[model samples]
Target: MALIDCIVLALYLIGTLAVGLHYAGRNQRSQDMFAAGGQSPWWVSGLSSFMTLKSAGTFVVWGGLAYREGVVAIAITTCIGVSAILVGLFVAGQWRRTGVTTPAEFVELRFGRAAVQLYTWAMMAVRIVSTGVALYAVAVMLVALVPLEPGHPLRDPASGHLSLAFAIFLFGAIVVAYTVAGGLWAVLMTDVLQFIVLQLAVLFVIPLLWLKLGSGAPLAPLPPNFFSPTSDQYTWWFMAGWVGVHFFLIGAEWAFAQRYICVPSDTDAKKSAYLFGGLYLISPALWLTPPILFRMLQADADPEQAYILASKLVLPAGMLGLMMAAMFSATASAISGQINVFAGVLTEQFYRRVFRPGASERNLVAAGRWFALLIGAALVAVALLVPVMGGAERIVLTLTGMLFGPLMAPTIWGLLSGRIGMAAVTASAGLVFLAGLWVKFGLDGPLGSPVLAAWVQANPRIADVLVGAVLPVAILTVAHLLRRTPQPAWRALQARVDAYAPTPPDEHGVDHAPAKVVAISLGASGLLTLALLAFNRDGRGALLVFGLSMLAIAWMAWRVSRRRPGPAN
Candidate 1:
């Protein structure tokens, strides 16, 4: 990397740390520490949710698919948007109205304490794996960008492991620093910056690539079946199954569910979901443009490296650094979001609830911070093993699919229906896990069953869809029938919900919702991004504009934070 590029990247890292530290001491109570005291504006939470959904895997994996398969990949990717719409319509408002701090708390409300405890631990494990996969993906991208010699120590089999481990830890440590310092406030604020950076990077690439490759001149001919839906590994049936998996995944995913609880009102929660859906709807164009262009130009390029290779080919020195920052931003946003929620679960669902019910607010806040560090470290360790696990994106999808599959039916059912008992829900979860494991791994372990393995192998995709969607619903239905217990009425549930209403931090007289500051930051950042796009001809000019814009946004944000109340206020 050039000296200018390294400086740009270093500045981004410094800015992220400063933002987190800027809000570090403001969280006086557990609520403020965990969910920003439930005062986050809908738009901020919405942008955070969108960025959380977009991990570095989205860039590497989905871009690879688009490069290999063509526009059909866009249709498959839209499942995320469709799922977001479904969540906004049905789940978001209900989550906010429940008044729970974490999704596991909602499990306690809807089911029982035992169920919530089980769920909290289960979700923590799932998130750790998911975040680890994200870390690994980003580390892979970073290593790819490094100009390693053929026999470099970092590329040697023995020392390459050390290099990979170092990359994972480096990424993890940076994310944990900000997350532990500011909690959700820092996470959301930095996420807004990350979202802007990532969006601008991709948007800039599109026009530049177009002008460079496919200007007014005639484009090169596409490969055979480039425009066909059934051209590649993604058949219509496969796409349908992908949609089915995400439909349930999005509705019950803990990350987005946590966002629903971060807002002041149910309306705000719903609006965030809607905003998330809208962004998902349009994000494909920005995300897929470079890869699509790559497909048309260099037909033989490695599919998974489409976006990275495009950056190398199209972006100049400073702009390439910005794109690298964008990649780091994607992974960091995801890791921070997961770590924040993990800390919440640790403090609220486990630490305070079980170990120290009488712990002070200060003690609990301290515990949450410690847990964030612990969990972040654990995820880094897991990421070290991801290189041997085939592909980072594939591992994430398969693991999350199996883990979240069974939980989805019970979660959605428990929220909407009031008649299901805790026992039934818990049992359904166990059965669904066994079923999903059989379909996913096919009894390849000590408990391997030859017959089941053969069946799974013969119809892998079909079995996946059945286990992920059909089997869970079936188990839930049977459980509901076998245990015909009437749950508490919705009125009673609402009463329980109201009891957990957020306590505003007005005694300090701090305006938690600084709408004006958010507006100024976003408006300034957006205008600056436009300026970079317009001034693309001069690399130095674009770099100068990006730097000044970041400085201006940071100054405005710092000023707003100074007005907010502190611990002693």
Candidate 2:
């Protein structure tokens, strides 16, 4: 990396930190800290939700898959959009209607305190460790771009790069600091900025690569199956199951539910989710193309590094730093979003509800900050240990498969149908858990039946979907139908939700400060892109396009900031 690249990256990190610190004093209560005081714009929440779903895994895991399998990766990932649309249409509004401060509170209402504890603790266990794995992956990728000389103080002598441990700690601390300082506001603003930078970086890559490849001729040599949407392991069945899994995930998962709850109204929540769905539906082609085109350039390139290598091949020095910043933003968006949600849950559900029942809102906010620190520390520790755990990624995938179906499916089912009680949730999840264990450990294992093993081998990706997604949902529905008794708490909550009506949210109050911040940040980024033309001439055309785009969005944001409240719809 050039000195200019380093400077650009430094500026981005500092700017993100500044944004966080800027909001430090704005959150006077736990609600403000955790959910932006229900004042965030629907679009902001929507974009944050989308960013929360990404991480370095977008580049490493999905990008690699795109490199090897062509368009199948997009087909698989587009399931996220399909799931989001389903949730937007059926579930997001329901969450907002419940008027719960956190998903844990909803769990407590629909099920019971016991279920809340079960759901919260289980989610934390799986999500925190997986978050650590993502953090580690980000560090590993970024550290590769920061090479060091033989005698450099920060260099790892053995591997001849910046020390991996140091890189992890550095990135982890940055995320934790910003998250602790600004809370949800920070997460939302940074996510919007990240989205802008990511789009600019990727949009530039396409035309540049096209010019290099000289149109459609170079792509002709690729294998025929490369263009097929359903490849070997990622079959249509797997994609359908993926959609089911994410539907539950986005619908009931605390992080995503936080997005719904944080918005102004039920309608806003639906809008946010719909925006997420719309973007996911349209943007995967743009997101996956750089890596796909890179395959034509170097068929033997490391799949995991396809995105970085492709960008590095075409992007000039300062723009490469912008790309790097965008990549870091992906992981930071996810990690910080999770930390914020976990802290909010711990603060609202445990700290205030159990220990300090009469605690003031300020006190609750302080406690939430402390909880954020604790969670961030734990996540960083997990990342440090990921190198020792060879199967960390696999562990995340397996746990997500096993847990999302048994845990989240029942939660979403309970949200939509009041027939199922806590007992039903327990029974459904328990049965699925047992079946999932048997499938994973018995049939898929060496000591199990040879016939079953062969079947599992033949349908490698199908078993998890069947056991994890399809079976749990089916059981939950059956259990709901069989239940003869109605639960009072569920009925009561449903009555409250049904009776509630929302007044128009104050447009002047909603995201007033965040809007200006976004405008200024984007405007500054646009200026910086234009400034790069003075130093590098080879990439002038791409830089101009990026600069103009950022400037246009910044102007729109400025207009939004200055708009007066109109008649309520």
Candidate 3:
């Protein structure tokens, strides 16, 4: 890496910390810290939610598939878009109508406090462990790419790369500091900034690679099946199952539920989800292009590293730093969202609701910050221990997938059907848990028959869908039908949802502060990029185009902040 690239990377990290500190004073109440006081614009929530899913895994995992199997990666990712749309239509508005601050609150109202306690502990464990695994994965990827000077204190002796432990700690500390200090407001704003950086960085790669491959039939030599929508390994059934898995995830998962809850009204919640879906639908063409093009350039290159290698081959000195920053942005966006969501649950669900019912809002906010610190510490510790855990990450991932049905089915079903009482929820979850164990252990474990295990190995995606989505949903439906009676809690909760009406848009007006912050940050990034024209003579056009794009979006944000709403009908 060049000195210019290092400077850009350092500045981006510092900017994230500055954003956190900037919003530290905004939380006079717990609502302000955790849910933006329900004042965040729908667009901000939408963009933040999208960034939460756009992690470094997108590049490492999907990019490898793009290199080896062309358009199939795009199809797999587009499943999330389909899920988002379905969720918006059926689920997002329901969350807002409930008027709950957290998903745990809704769970308690429908299933009793016992369910809340069960879900809080169980989901927190799953989220923390899974996030640690994600952090560890990204750090390992970074250490392979980032080299250190000979005999440098932080360099690995054998690899001459940055130490894996240092990479994990460094990125972990950055995420923790911002989330603990600034809360959800910090997470939202940083997400917007990171999205811009990531989009611009990848957007630049397309033009550079295109210009380099001037006038050639670059894709002619590739296999004919490379362009097929469904590869042999990722077939049509797998795609359908993949879609179902994400539907349960995006429709009812706590992180996404928080996005729906934090918006101003049910309408805003729907709009936010729609925006997320639209982005996923439109973005794959741009995000996956570089790796596909790079496959033609270097057919023998390591598929997992194809995306980063493409950037290194084509991007200029300072811009390579921006690309590296974008990679960090991917992981940071995800980890920060998880930290903030769990912190909110610990504060609102456990601390205030159970331990101190009469605690002041100030105290609740303080407790939230403390909880954030604790969860962040735990995440770092787990990430640092991943190497010694020996396939523990894979185990944790499988466990999380298995639990999704038990966890999400009850919550989503409760929203739509009053017939699904706590008894059904408990029964379905127990049955589903046992069924998941059978699938994972009885069919695929070492003790299982080799023939069955081999089939599961070849079609793991279909098995996951059956165990995680199809079976739990079936159990819940059957148990609810057997009950045939609505609980009093469901009736009262349904009454609240039906009777609630949001404040009129004209009366509530818009909160322009977030838009203003976004505009200023984007403008600064644009001006900085434009200034780099003084140094890079060879890449003047790419810098000019990207800088102008940033400024254009910044102007749009400023316009949003200044605009006033008309009177409502």
Best by TM-score: 2
User: Which ten residues in a row are the worst by lDDT in model 1?
Assistant: 526-535
Q: List the residue pairs that clash in candidate 1.
A: none
RMSD of each: 4.7, 2.2, 2.6
TM-score of each: 0.86, 0.95, 0.93
lDDT of 3 at 289: 86
lDDT tens digits, residue span 351-450, model 2: 9989999999889989999999999999999888876876344655576666787889888888888788888788777888888777777775665788
lDDT of model 2 at position 344: 93
Stretches of candidate 2 off by over 4 Å are 215-224, 391-396, 444-447, 503-511, 566-569
The most accurate candidate by lDDT is 2
lDDT of 1 by residue, 354-403 (tens): 89999999998999999999999999988888767777767765665556
Off-target runs (Cα >4 Å) in candidate 3 are 215-224, 385-401, 444-451, 503-508, 564-569
| Candidate achieving higher lDDT, 1 or 2 | 2
For model 3, the local distance difference test gives: 0.82
Give lDDT: candidate 1, residue 413.
Answer: 77
lDDT of each: 0.75, 0.85, 0.82
TM-score of 3: 0.93
